[model samples]
Target: MLAFAGAGLWLLLAGPADVLGIDSGNAGMVLLMTATWTALYQVGRLPPEDVVRVGSPAEWKAWIGTAFMAAAIAYFLTRGEVLAGVTVFNDPHAQRIGRNLVLLLVAWSVLSSVMASRWKGVVEQDERDREIAAQASGWGRGALVAVVIGLAVLLGLSPASRLAWASHLMIANLLIFALMWSCFVEYAATAAYYWRERRWQ
Candidate 1:
């Protein structure tokens, strides 16, 4: 939910609507993504377990790939030309990564759900899995909170002249980075736990 909504808003805020090339149905797609977000969020504010489908530890490890892919798409589309030297890409300030991020999140969510459901009724996960998840989630969320607080302090204490790059669009990017960083931390931690615990068997 956060992934989809945040990404969609990330693009829409870069709007004048026209700058997004919305005449090609990207606008409808963003609207659809937002509507889906609203619907999911409105469903009684469901518990995380109810909404987040879990698969085997191996499957969870695979999700790290999804997070990395989303991050790559965000970079290549928004700022790839910076390294690639192609005039076809023109997001110097990274105001457009959200469009790609939204698509990647939605696609990855659907794919992960379908994959997770393959284990339905068989009950693959055990208490150990849950323990790792709890621990990993704490690592992820704690890292996110700490980074956001650090950013707040940096922005608050720094002289305005030194912080001129922190525009509204850039702040949006920072929020996006924070979320992505958390997911990376969580997924990587989960994978690491599984790998380390495998020696116990």
Candidate 2:
């Protein structure tokens, strides 16, 4: 987990900077957001017996509360800053980048928390759930593989398609994220079932 955190920090510093063309302040905000977001995710995933039940009304309240919390964090992190020096909405590229980042962070937090809550029910899985999970995993894997191949071809042809390269890359990144997320969901479902099965037996 420390290794994972370290890698995330590295990506936030090196990868997001180059991708977003952001300098120090924006980079720092993004890094802080990423770190906090990850921390919240881990907190949400605490074992059912160890933490608040995620699907309960209280947990729902917490999830909504955290969205506001995240918004506050984003505003404070970006407020009165160099990146905000430019008109936030006027520049299409900057606006899109910022919007994507914000939405991604909030949505990740909400969804992860909900899933952690649902994981309690997931612990009671049966054979039907396992079979459905198997199917989902198979389909998700195929789709993920296809997307990777398609993206690779697009990357190879990017030099030739220079006119829309930026747009292509941006969309490609979104699609890659979606595919990765789907694959992860499938794997998580399967793993959860096996874990529950072990506990049951």
Candidate 3:
């Protein structure tokens, strides 16, 4: 899928373009997400005869939208409608919408996960499930560390004049963005691993 590794290259080489009202940076992510859904949804389209392998991905597919939605909320909350430099938390107009959306989304995801998954089963997670989860966990942690280190380098090495827009509030949301990104990475990897196993079947 062009939306995987290729998509990032396309985004970097293409620079930034306008699509409708959104920038290529945002649109590029949507493109990648479309690919994620396209690929991962195929797992369910032809599930193998293994409960352990099929269980996590099927459930993860259901929450892909949730992850994307949460990311969007974070994106919006990280900026002001008039001032991109200020976080929604400090921007009066954007704060209310961001707070309410975050609360509702968190609640919705929790309920959705509980309802969609067969957690009551005696088997719970098998060896395959544990393996996938562990792999995903490692990926998430690595992504988080990379994001943090990158941010530190940018702030530490760059001249203050060059980073004039880096408000305290903005820095705070950047950390939030880092966490969100790591979670998204973990989720994508989990779903991908699950989907990858299905192709052979």
| Candidate models: Cα lDDT each | 0.58, 0.50, 0.58
Q: Which candidate is the best by TM-score?
A: 3
Ranking by lDDT: 3, 1, 2
Better of 1 and 2 by TM-score: 1
TM-score of each: 0.59, 0.35, 0.61
Collision pairs in model 2? none
Which digits, one per residue and each the tens of the lDDT, describe model 1 over residues 1-201? 666655554553333445445532255345545655465346326443553343353445445444444444454445433333322234533334445556656655774565455445645567877788889899989979987998899999999988656666556656767887777777778877776776575
Using lDDT, give the best candidate's number: 3
- The sequence of per-residue lDDT tens digits that candidate 3 reaches over residues 1-201 is 644625733542253455576554545554654565455456435534453344553445425644554444444544433234454465644463345335434644654564345333535556887888799889989989999999999999999889876777667766876777777777778777777776666
Candidate 2, 1-201: lDDT as tens digits: 455444544443334435457543345445555665676578666766655332333333334444434343433334324233444335654554456456545655665576566556544444665575676577667766777677678667778556243453355444645554454545444545445654797
- TM-score quality measure for candidate 3: 0.61
TM-score for candidate 2, please give it.
0.35
Number of backbone-clashing residue pairs for each candidate, in the order shown = 0, 0, 0
lDDT comparison, 1 vs 2, better candidate: 1
